[model samples]
Target: WAYPMQPIQSAAMSGIGYSPIGPVEGTWVVGFFRDGENAQDPVMLGTIGGIPQNFPGSDGFNDPNQVYPLSNLNFHGLGEPDTNRLARTIGTDILGRDSKEHPVVTQKLSTTPLFDESTGTPIPYPGVPIESEGGDIRRIPKALAEGNFWVEPPTDAPFTP
Candidate 1:
């Protein structure tokens, strides 16, 4: 197992306050070996995001399990750079080139086959006051009551939603 170096932001003081690094399988990471020359013990600095050149395969130098780069009915993010769209909005980027802003959540949710016209897939979600933290898009209170909101259903859900 690799030893992950904690960031300066993280409080790695006591045993009480420790957070695990979350670099998952198929995630390309930048790291070095603790026992120099011997690649037995890895010291992971962080993961890197980049444009995937090819689909994963069950060979060396790539996803050996071939688990990642999963495809949906339409979306297969191969070749596309993994820049977080929210990070750079129109007029906010360092480059002077003007880029379009992300559409409202309630608008046409997805272009892929997962786009559901019913619940307006990827509907308006709640936001938090704190900006530094990251979280998932959540539904507004009693949003389902408004009707036509069934979206990507949970596996346990009996009916489609």
Candidate 2:
């Protein structure tokens, strides 16, 4: 789920659950993963998007204010069974982030595997290089493996256009 990290554009946009930290819009953000002492490899979950919803206003506006979904939301990651190391890592990485900044949500499955299609298993971990269609290729990190991550939206999440 390697998403493009972008820079915040304004003072009004400089808080938790805000937009990303770069110039690209809605780039794929990645959540790293590991197995025991070894970094298992990261997974390509999905892109982050904004969602809009209504909220009650305290200033006596009478009508609820239109707010982004992630503005007041908090997300918790679910750990898979039978793995103590996995549980610990999940707790530290996913739960450790500020809910206002990094909201948690379910990770979506990718249609394409990060490894070579001819081989069902992953390509070489940590150092194997991958070539893409647009002449862009590089060695992927070991933190990106199958089945080890999730994503969540913000409370005041905006509508991604």
Candidate 3:
């Protein structure tokens, strides 16, 4: 049996509160065996992440139920990492995004925002922080522009709210 490690954030109590999930299929983990020479009891330390270039195989060590790296023509965020780009500290500033990265973050926020055809929600845009001084997002931004930025249906979409 494989023994998995948990982060300090996990309470590790009676199977409740903040537990690190065990690695799923296709996840690359690094670890060692507790039994040393026995090499039977593997201890999974952590998972390795990267841009998944290839799809999972049919046999082993891969996702069995679904195909991965879905066709770019069929899906968005194909080459993106597990964590959203806007959530990563790539450039200096708010929402982990800066004006410096071309075509990645803020640049696309204004110039060309991709919207959801069904919901009209801008898919490419990140949920901007609402606070004035530092953009804290805890409270909603009361005084901001509001309108249908996407398309024009015959009447308002069913999701108008």
**Counted clashes in each candidate structure:** 3, 38, 0
The lDDT for every candidate, in the order shown, is 0.37, 0.29, 0.38
TM for every model, in the order presented, reads 0.41, 0.15, 0.36
Error of 2 at 63 (Å): 52
Give a tens-digit lDDT track for model 3, residues 36-109.
Answer: 99999998766544456556668777667664333332122235543322234222332322332321222222
Candidate 3 colliding pairs: none
Minimum summed lDDT over a 10-residue window in model 2 is located at 9-18
Which candidate has the highest lDDT of all? 3
Q: Can you tell me which runs of candidate 2 are displaced by over 4 Å?
A: 1-80, 84-96, 99-103, 106-111, 115-140, 143-161
RMSD, one per candidate, in order: 16.1, 18.7, 16.8
Answer with 1 or 3, whichever has the higher lDDT: 3
lDDT of 1 by residue, 74-113 (tens): 1135665433222212111211112222312333222233
Model 3 local distance difference test score: 0.38
How displaced is residue 21 in candidate 2, in Å?
30
On TM-score, who's better, 1 or 3?
A: 1
Cα misplacement distance, residue 58 of candidate 1 (Å):
1.8
